[model samples]
Target: MNLTTTAKPIVIIGAGIAGVHAAETLRNEGYEGRIVLVDRDTQLPYDRPPLSKEFILGELSEADISLRSNESLTALRIELKLGVEIVSIDAKKKIAISSDDEILEWEKLLLTTGSSLRKLQVKGSDLEGIHYLKTLSDAKAIRQKLDGIQQVAIVGAGFIGAELASSFKKQGKEVTILERMPLPLAHILGEEMGEYFLQLHQSEGVHVITEDAVVQFDGTTQVEKALTEKGRIIPCQAVIVGIGVIPNTFLSDKELHVDRGYIVNEFGETSLPNVYAAGDCAMWPYRGDNIHIEHWDHAVNHGKCVAKNLLGGEPISYTAIPYFWSDQYDHRIQYFGHTKNWDSAVLQGNMEDKQFTYFYLNESGVIDAALLVNQPKNALAVRRLIKQQQSVDSDLLSNPEVNLKNVHVQENEDKVSY
Candidate 1:
């Protein structure tokens, strides 16, 4: 638990973006210590953003999605143990026990285990054609099985599901999306935006059913149909479940506080002094509340922050605003900030015009987040506004004539709440 020690190797669990970037960051920060990166995935750690989109559509290969090259890993002196699972961690001794019963000790530990895709628990979920596109293997399986497949049933309308649906539609496969919500992305983007997503999918020849949950998958040896609780059966040759993910927190101990993720401080330090976490597995502070952001950008930022702080310098707070983007059909949806408790949203531009931006406001009138559709420039403006925590008039935000970059943020009377 000695945070100042730099003699022992840094053992990083999970060779995803966070873990790999942390190793890179530590080297960049001039730390010449040993670095060990481990993961259960046998393949090289790769970028996951393309798994459902370009990768599934056959536009990108596994090599294209890789975050690091072999040359880079060797240059950074990162010892990668692929296909190796760390069964448990001995926090007191700073030791990680692998699935193969190999023990490794560390001066500092980083838990970037990320999360696992939530599996469908209904009957016939184990069928051959049912898929969950979380890993490279999953995407490869789906790509191979998609050969000669006619229809695909998507189980959710979240980002992953929507992206997969768009990919399938682009690949000339019949896509049917079953969303339990009234509209796609309803909980995150609200009704109107969700409806726009519905229209976008429909315009691309994808079928959608709202407020429907798949009760079971029906097929003999492979998934052929999805039976919904609403008494509807969707016929398809394959099924992809994109319900969500659960954070990997099984390795947490009494020294590490575990909630939805491993609770960490602003510097990514867990309750244990020398142990830290980042990425989807780390829940750190966000404006007074603890939030675990699962986006790729957040992972990169967190890894750098943890590396900087782990070097025993002035602790750098990991307060970078979370940003995420999804490309579906002709639209590129860019969002910044966390919109957990947004009270109101104002939309500018015409949804029919195919260009619009939505500004999310907290109860205190401060801009908390923004969603821009095919408006990349406005995304920068919104990012600045959110970074400044500016409270602008809702009318100005809603006015199409007013340029958001020029619109001044007002100090609302609700400033006391924050």
Candidate 2:
């Protein structure tokens, strides 16, 4: 199903960074076809990373973070159908059915539908003051209601929860973070680093409650307090739930292989022909297995890759290294690569000085992932090494005097664990 021979539009079922970038990339690749960008959001596509950071701090506005300029989409001749929900996709007919019974036939379809915030299933979860920050409107609502709020309770201690804690604490608002885990980011960063993060939050004057669950919200009209399972009551005027997000895979039918997200090949194409998926909604091939990444850089690169492949040229495998960063208080934590399991993690520099790089090694002693705190240069070098799939000297990696760029791997020096 080459799009060049068809008259139907190349429809993108999202208007976020990924979808918008795909449309722009298509135009940049000399694709002069009908491109339609559909999104459930009415506002112009804006940057999402700032929503939990600068936006919450009142340092950035929606206009300042707009992904594309006002005339950019029009200049590219891309049609936008904002605030419209896509009901389903007919792969055989190459058409998308909208919620309003509108049919859109497509020469090629890209699903960058993204993800939705995971809702808490506890009692009184539907209370008025409970907030979930995901979209721009969600941020706006939080900002509007945050003024004069003395005691605020934050559920979950992930990225969003931690960032919100920092933001609120900066404003001198008393913030209490309730986490079900023993420590913040325990599963990802390991318990040691998680403890460091916990200490970091405490140093910032943010109260941390670990291994506690909010059983219910206790209030009449608005949330006044949270009742914990441990027989404790956390008094607060507002609550922010930031446990996690679930991929928006509702549109994926039997024809489209769906697990946690829409399954895609190396080229970002789904099982059905002329159908593609990317961003947070797409579970793509990574290394030897399929993984879904919900990061800004991954989504942008995914969109670009899908655009090139959808242009009917040589298929480009979307195997770019995944990167993610988190900004809390004054600490900048940057991570490169992907790994669920690692044999050991070698630490470089001084963790006591709050400046260090940790390398996660596979069973074969090859670096699968590396994270650096306030060390951008080391992060870049590690990213390069990981992309090259090269092994490094563990001694030099642990030695602060040794430069990471000098640690190179010969072809024979690398070995596979399995």
lDDT of each: 0.87, 0.89
Error of 2 at 120 (Å): 0.8
For all predicted structures, in order, the TM-scores are: 0.95, 0.97
**lDDT (10s digit) by residue, model 2, range 298-375:** 999999999889988679988899999989898898989999888888999888888899988887667889888989
Candidate 2 wrongly placed segments (more than 4 Å): 1-5, 411-418
Top lDDT hit: 2
User: What's the distance in Å from true for residue 336, model 1?
Assistant: 0.8
Candidate 1 lDDT (Cα, whole model)?
0.87
For model 2, give the 10-residue run with minimal summed lDDT. Answer: 409-418
Across residues 1-418, which tens digit of lDDT does each residue of candidate 1 receive?
A: 1244456798999899898989898888888788899998999989999998999989998889998987889988999989888989887888999889999999888999999988889988898899888889999999999989999999999999999988888888999999988999978888878888999888889999998899988889988899999899899999999999999998857767999899998999999878999999989999899997888999998987887777786788988999999999888999899876678989899999889998889877888988999889787678877888756777778888877777544456432221
Output the lDDT of residue 66, model 1.
Answer: 90
lDDT of 2: 0.89
